[model samples]
Target: MSQQRIETIQKWLKDQNAEFAFIQSKANLFYLTGFRCEPHERLISLFVFQDKEPFLVCPNMEKPLISQAGWAYPIIGYSDHENPWELINKYLSTYSFEQNIAAIEKEALSVARHEQLQNLFPTFTFVNCEQGIMEMRLIKNEDEIAILREAAKLADFGVEVGINAVKKGRTEMEILALIEYELKKKGIAEMSFGTLVLSGENTANPHGHPNTKQIKEGDFVLFDLGVVVEGYCSDITRTIILGQPTEQQEQIYSTVLKAQEETLHICREGTILGDLDRKARSIISNAGYGEYFPHRIGHGLGSEVHELPSLNETNNDRLQVGMTFTIEPGIYLPGVGGVRIEDDVLITKQGHECLTKFPKELQIIHS
Candidate 1:
């Protein structure tokens, strides 16, 4: 972890008056310790507190890999079969932190793990630390932004391939398969979410999954996908007409594009996120498509696909520089297909930078 990050954690611990914080989420663990270990039903955890170096606990089998990650902390490895709670408790008992409040990741900690920890440390109070950690990571740093930029670039390349794959006689599943293949070819090992390849009336579903229905002429095709790079994520969506678009299809597409463009122009640091959502939604609403635009304008993107500072009417979190998220607005009409345009954007000092630079103009693919 960087010195600045460590200092930030220390300040947060001080403000919260916490003796130590136990982080078990794989993504959070990687963010703090710079060690990328799978949290696969195992008790790989990290403990950090004030005036003390952080400590990592993992199975002995993972020691070599953990060591290579260059974590500036003590790595305590126990046998896979040994009771990890017992080992952790023994270490805790030796310290003077008895009866002190220890913050634990409430959201990510499984019930079984929480019960085990409670039983082991009956004297210490365990409090929720998930929100505290999330607050810390909501804003991106320089290194995180760089990773997100690269992830967006990779998604752009994959989108081009996916758009080209849409053709007459091709199934939605086949188009998705092609996108996945291109993502892998571009070295993206993980997808932020399942690839959504919706066609025709299916496009009315915002979260539609790829199906076996074959593509045909004059059908609307929507591609919503993202790629994960070094634990950071990027999301982008584009809608295309398989053949020539009908008059109504063209109208809906133009309205959606105008809304997205206007919202993008107004996005900047300190702007109320909900205001951005409303700006785009008002356009669709005035055009009599408000009911079709059901979901929020966008969401924060980072280690986990969805983070803090949601772009919605209910959220009042002000945008800050270094924050990266998506700006997606759509108009979905049931039985009439839908049109959506989305892009990954980085909040900058002046305005916002569009990371997903792939063409958003409606493309007409011929047979």
Candidate 2:
């Protein structure tokens, strides 16, 4: 377990007037316990108390792996035949004999689990720990940023592979496969999300899926992909043209690129998150493509692809050093190709670091 993070949660519990809480989300479980796992249908949880050794509750099959992952605490494991919730309640009773207010990651805990928890403790006052955890994860520590930096390098390389795979008749799925195959050869087991290779009119959709469409001259090919390194994730999107562009195509690409570049220039500490979104939006709006840009500026990223502090027009949260997020601006016209330039960024003491350094300048792949 990370002693510092454990203490942070302990203090948060004390502040919330919560006797104890359940950290159920896998991301948070790894953050506090230094162990990451997907419970899938099985149960994997952590019980943090105000003044006691936090206990781990997981499937019996993962007991040894949990210990190997450096969780030095009491563990409650259940076999497939056992009722996990009943076992959890029995152990929780030993920790908190009688309590009314129970703190939990309300967002992560399902309604079914909440019902089960209420069943165990009839008189329960559920306290939401989601805010506390979200606030805590807002800032990235040096170690986390370090891993993120490396992850960003991999994301950039993935974009490069995508660009190189462009050919006269390569299918979108073929390009996607090539990117992943190359990344896997270099030891990337999983992408932060599904590898995306959108082309032609499909690029008009912000979250378009890769398909079997063959490349054609003058088509726009978009590569939106990321990879997980250690526990951190990196996301990037770069749109390129298959051949020389028309006047309108060049204008749209340059406008989107300018919006991204200008916004990134002011990404220093102290900028309001909302203001950043507006700055990018205004640039697109002034260019008469406001309606073409549908999504917000960007979203927070770290252990998960999307997290807290979404960059929208109303959130006034101030960016601080050690925070990491993406600044992606795009313009999509229905029935026409689109352009989106995304970069993973880290707020620094003085300015910011652009982790995904893949060139934003439009690349034209000759037919």
Candidate 3:
């Protein structure tokens, strides 16, 4: 499985005119090597070339695990206190890559590491490879899509548990506990983000953390959570009303749902992101909730909760088939509550496919 990904990366490196590329980002490393490692002050980096086999440089303690993964690459281990620059320089010299241009992940490479590399090999040239690699990962392959689908299914089940657990006197923290418990029950080891269970006026905060405030009758209940399954992530949000919703709340909920549905309808391959965002924002704005809708419509999702090809009015990138992202639109009223409905979407040649199958209609749960 990893061999195919390595071959694909090699082809991409050749096309980009890169002599060699270094990958240090934890998520990218997992994608390329199928070996997961915790990120720490001690860096574990991988080097790949167009024709040669990939090589990994890490602390001595990690060699056993790396070897157990059955990677067909050379593993170079160094002492914990030893300078990694010395080992890297020796390896490069042995490979006869002196003075060659090397592509480095500027986003992940620290200034300290950069300085060490420069000092070790003053003749070598370093180029920023972050964008090149990110572009390659933007589109999801078949395996990646399958994992994301499973993640979405698990997230839907978690949402169902959270909604049912909502009560008039339950605290926001209790609701979050129920959501996480349900996620764990479905075999989700880690969440894409912390569970957000906001009630009443606290729902107005888009990224607010759950607190101990008890939910009141006739208050809005917001849930934004996701789970990581097989390295891919699934993110979704659903808002419900406790008891009965007022006329204004009902109107706001309807407007947000309409915006989400319209956006999904127009999102497809070859569509401009800016236009897609406008289609959703225009619906809310036309409904007289322009100021309430402040954030972007959505963002790309994959190994990371947020990746590239953001969906917003400012983004002009054209949508391509196999791209996956979220479509979340909300309205926040200060001193009141907010309503946000989000789902995972995948772009296809024919049109857009909604991966999240949760009900979008506002649920009125009597306390």
Candidate 4:
């Protein structure tokens, strides 16, 4: 755990006149405490104070794991049968606050949970702390960039596995399973999200899922997957052709690749973030495939697969050094197959680094 981060949030709480801040999201918890756990339906939170030391509340069973993750603070744990809110209230009630204001993760907290907190502190005024936390997490430190590079290497390996698994008559689900199974052998415990291996017409759908559709000659196979390493994530996408490609297929593939590369070429500090999307969109539009292209250029990547600083045309944020995100450009035709090229990019003092190093050239696999 970084004491500096803890102090940073405490300073923010003081500046906001909030006595304490409740961090409930798993991603934020992992960010602050260095402990990663998926407590589905279980109460787990970190309470930071403006003038007092902080404490963590979680299921009693996870106390040891949290400590093992190097959290040096008071841990208030409750069993499944106990009311976690009561424990939290009893512990926090010891401190007398000058103000009744507290900060909460408005995005992660549910109405029921808000009511529970309200019942505990009847006069407490809850304010949104999610945006503040996001601002802190937006920039990548050297250590974080190191972990992301490793994750990107693993994501590249996953794509390699998927491409090699493609075979005549093999179903899309079959190839997806092969990719994850191979990754597990290499010590990957989890993927950032569902592994996607779309074949032929399935590639036209931006959010296609793997299924029993078999691979065949003259099909465009797309692999989009990522792996999580040490709480960080890497996302990548690559599309390949089975057998020979027609003129239209080659044009679409080349257009998407050009769009991705041109956008990546302009990445650096002080560049308008939205212009990256505009750059890619213009390339696709000039190629007469604008209507077929949907979605933004990309999104920020870090502890969570999809995070802040969205790469959309509407956002006017400037790209800063230490900021990491994806530069993905694609063109999807409804009846025909589509092509996408995605890379995890990190803005550097000089220019930018493409973390995911899997080759982007269109590969034609002989079926």
The count of residue-pair clashes in candidate 4 stands at 0
lDDT of 1 by residue, 141-229 (tens): 88888999999998888789888887899999998999898788778788989989999999999998779999889999998889888
TM-score of each: 0.95, 0.97, 0.94, 0.99
Q: Is candidate 2 or candidate 4 better by TM-score?
A: 4
Clashing pairs for model 3 are none
Deviation from native of the Cα of residue 304 in model 1, angstroms? 1.7
After TM-score superposition, the amount by which residue 34's alpha carbon in candidate 3 deviates from its true location, in angstroms, is: 1.3
Per-residue accuracy of model 2 over 181-254 as CA lDDT, tens digit each: 99999999989998889999999999998899998999999999999887779999999999889998999999
Model 2 / residue 334 / CA error / Å? 0.6
Give the alpha-carbon lDDT of every model. 0.85, 0.89, 0.87, 0.93
Top candidate, metric lDDT: 4
What total of clashing residue pairs does each candidate reach?
0, 0, 0, 0
- The TM-score leader among the candidates is 4
Error of 4 at 263 (Å): 0.2
Q: Give per-residue lDDT, candidate 1, residue 187.
A: 82
Residue 363, model 4: lDDT of 99
User: What's the TM for model 2?
Assistant: 0.97
Model 3: residues with Cα > 4 Å off, grouped in runs: 15-17, 68-70
CA lDDT for candidate 2: 0.89
- What TM-score number comes out for model 1? 0.95
